[model samples]
Target: MSQQRHELLPTETHDELARESFVQALKSHIATRVSPGVREIYDHRVRDRWVSEHGAEPADRHEVREALSADTYYRLWSSVRRSSQHLLWSSVGDAVTRQADDLAARARVADAGLGTLRLDPDLEIPWYNAEVDIHAMPGGYRGEYMAGDVSVGAVYDRGVYVYAMGQMGALNDDYGHSICQNLLAASYPEFTPRRILDMGCTVGNSTLPYVDAFPDAEVHGIDLGAPVVRYAHARAESLGRAVHFSQQNAECTDFPDGHFDLIVSHIVLHEMSPAALRRTLAECRRLLAAGGLMVHADFAGYAGVDPVTQAMIDWDTYNNHEPFWGPMRDMDLVADAVSAGFDDGAVSIETVLTGRVLQTGKQQRAGQLTLLVGQA
Candidate 1:
C-alpha cells in the first residue's frame, strides 16, 4: 500500500504510481523468495566447502564474508538487493521530479504558522555525507538540484516506505512511535521533558511523533540538509504539529549547552563515521540538561550474534555504500556513551523488539532495534 500523502507529498500520476507499486512488489518478492535461498546455499555449499578446507566451521563473520564472496548465489542475491534499492529511488524520483516546483510551492503555502524553519546555506556538508550516496539513493540526502530543491527529501520520504516494504507504517514513523510509546513511556513514566531535540532528523518523519507523545513539550529537529529541513518544516505544519526544524550538523550545533531535556535520534548513528559519531555522542551529552535522557536507536547490534547473521548484516557495508555500518555495530556503544560524559552506571546498550513486523508472502522477520541510552 502507498503512504497516506499529506499536502507536501508529491502527487503521483497513474503511471508513476503503477511503477512504484511494481517496484514494491518486486522488492517484496526478492525478500521472501530470493533472500532465503542465500542461507540454503551457504549451508549446503559454502559451509561444506569451509569445513573441508579449514577443518572447522567458519570462526567469524570475516570468514563467512570471505567464503560467501566467491559464491555465485550469494552474489546474485546481493546484486538483486542492490538493484532493488536503486529501483526504489528511481521509481520515487520520477514523481518527485515531475512535480518538484509545485511541491516546493505547496511547502511554502502549507506553513500553518505553528512551527519554524531555520536553514544555513553555508553550513559545511560533512565528508561522510558528501562522499557517497548512502543506501544507493541517487542524490544521497542533501542533494539540491534547483533553487528551492526539496526533490531529494520527497524521494526519501516515499522511498523509505518501499524500501522497508511498508513495514514502517503510514508515515514511516514507526521507529519514533515505537520508542516513545513502548520504551520511554514504560521505562520512565514520571519523566516529562520540557524541551526535546532530534538529531539527524531527515524530513522529520521520526521527529513529529514526539509532538504527539508530549504535546506541551517544545519539539525541535536538526539535520545537515537544507532541503530536508525545509520539507520537514512544511510537512509538520501541514500535519498541524508544531515542530521546529533546522539545518545544522549534529556534531556541532548553534544550540546552547544543556538546552534540551530529552535528546533522541532514530536510525541515525550508523550513517555517521566513527569520529563524527563520537563527537555527536559527546555533543548529545553536552546538550542534555541535568537528569535528562538521551537515546540513539538503530538496527540490531553485532555483539554475540552468529557469524552468518553478522555477515548478513554486514552486507550493507560493502554493497550498500554504508562504510560505517559494520564498524558502528561492533563498537561498544555503552562505553562510548560513558566516554561522552555520561555516568558509567547511567548508560547502557540494549535491544528491544519494536513489534512492527512486516509479513511478506510466507516469511516472518523480527522487527528489532538496538538502543544506546544515557541519562545525565
Candidate 2:
C-alpha cells in the first residue's frame, strides 16, 4: 500500500489501499474472466436456443438487448460490470480528495521549472461534457470545487489503472504508442512530423508517448480539464518529457492556423456529440499544417461483430454515461473526414493492434477497434 495521498494518517492510508485494492481485484475478475463466462453461456446456450425457437437470430444489438433483457445471467453480468465501474471511480475519488492539495502543490514545484501548464479560467466547457459524466466518473473531468483542486485529475489518473486492470501496461501510454507505431511504420513510412498535438488528453496518459515516438517534434496536449492538465504537465516534467499541456476544448483552440504537422486523439470522439465531433474535426484541419496527418483512435471496434457482441458493447453507452458512444461507432468516419476537407482517397482505416488498443480499424467500417486517418 502506497502513501500516495498526502497528509494522511497511516490508518487512513491502509484503509484506502485495502478498499481500492479490493475494488480493483473485483473489477479485473469481472472484466477478464467472469463477464466472458457469462458471454460464453449466452452465446452457446441462450442465443442458440433463441435462434432455433424464434426462427431467426437477433436482427441487431437492439433486438438482442430486448431478447436477453430479462435473462438472469445477462442481468447479473450487466449489473455487476456497471457497478464495478462506478465503484472504481468512487474509491479513487475518496483518495483524491485527501491528496488534491498535495497534487496541486507538487504541480507548482515539479521539475524545478520544467514543462508548461496553461489553463484558462474563462474557458467554456462544452455542453456535451456538462450533460453527463463520461465513464461514470463523478464530477466528470473538468469539475473543480476549489481554487487549485486536482481531485478530478488525481481520481482519473489512479482510477484508470484500476479500470484497465493492468491491460494498458505499466506506463499506461500504450494507447498512444500503439497508434503512433501503426501510423508511422505501416501507414505513413515517409512522413516525419515536426510538431504534434493530442486532443482531450486526460493527464497526458496518452500524450507523453508521442514525445518518445517523435523525439524531435514539439509535443502539445489540450483538454478542457484544468486540473488534469496541471497533473499532466507535472507528470511529464517529472518523467523528463517536455510536453506542453493546455486547458483548451478540442472544438476550438487558440493556436495559429497550420501550427502542427501531426494531430492525434485517443478515445475522445465517442464522448462527443455529432455536432461537436464535426467541429473538432474541422478544428483539427485548421490546426494541422499542409500535408500533415490526423489520427483519432477509439474503442468503436465494430469489425466482425455480430448482434451478441454489439449488444454487449452497447451496455457501456446506457450504463457507463457514454451518450454518444453507440452512434460514434456507427458513424461514417470516411465521409466525415472528407467533409472536413481531407482527401477522399487519403481517408482510410489503419490497422488497430491487439493486446491493448481495441480494434476500430477496418476496410468496411467493422473491426475490433477503429482508426480514422487522413491528411490535411
Alpha-carbon RMSD of each model: 1.6, 4.6
C-alpha lDDT score of every prediction, in listed order: 0.88, 0.78
lDDT (Cα) of model 2: 0.78
Specify the highest-lDDT model's number: 1
Off by over 4 Å in 1: 51-56, 358-365
Per-candidate TM equals: 0.96, 0.87
Which candidate leads the pack in TM-score? 1
Clashing pairs in 2: 303-366, 303-367, 359-368, 359-369, 360-369, 360-370, 361-369, 361-370
Report the lDDT of model 2 for residue 50: 74
Q: Output the TM-score of candidate 2.
A: 0.87
- Give the Cα error of residue 177 in candidate 1, in Å: 0.9
C-alpha lDDT (0 to 100) for residue 162 of candidate 2: 64
Off by over 4 Å in 2: 1-12, 37-57, 301-303, 354-369
